[model samples]
Target: EPEVTQTPSHQVTQMGQEVILRCVPISNHLYFYWYRQILGQKVEFLVSFYNNEISEKSEIFDDQFSVERPDGSNFTLKIRSTKLEDSAMYFCASSEWTGELFFGEGSRLTVL
Candidate 1:
């Protein structure tokens, strides 16, 4: 079975530093997305990418964040300047169609 995979399951960085989280979605899926959960908080949508372009984004994806598909197989999210509030579990997901998401084991980011 195909599944999404994320690297560096845990990441720790200092405030003001930069961090990049990587994901590889199911090979044949067409849509990819990044979602996050601040500790004890509800999961929130960050951005969605399809056809190599941003299909949708939430208010949280401000200037500090960017998403890229460096190659067909890998997707990445870069945070230019980390903040204490940036600490959270970031999930990568993909689906053959909207509303049916297949998620990766989250990458936990901690900023100090």
Candidate 2:
């Protein structure tokens, strides 16, 4: 079975710096999403992308965050400025219009 894959399994950055997380979802999947979990917190939805445009986004996806599928296969999330609170395990997921989501091994971001 195919699964989403993320690059830079772990990242360390200073507060105020920028970071980019990259992912490649299942080849035939249509919807892609970004979710994060702060250390011991619940998984929080950030944004969903479909048909090459943003389909839905949570308030957490503020101006500091942005996502793009520069190519048909690779999706990327960029944080314009990192904050201490931004440190978390970011997961990349993809699925069909309706079904279970396949998530990549999360990329852990550490901001100090």
Q: Estimate each model's TM-score.
A: 0.98, 0.97
lDDT tens digits by residue: candidate 1, 69-88: 99899999999999999999
Report residue 29 deviation for candidate 1 (angstroms).
Answer: 0.5
TM-score of 2: 0.97
Best by the lDDT measure: 1
Score residue 78 of candidate 1 by CA lDDT. 97
Q: Give, for candidate 2, the lowest lDDT window spanning 10 residues.
A: 94-103
- Alpha carbon lDDT of each predicted model: 0.97, 0.96
Question: Which regions of candidate 1 are displaced past 4 Å?
Answer: none
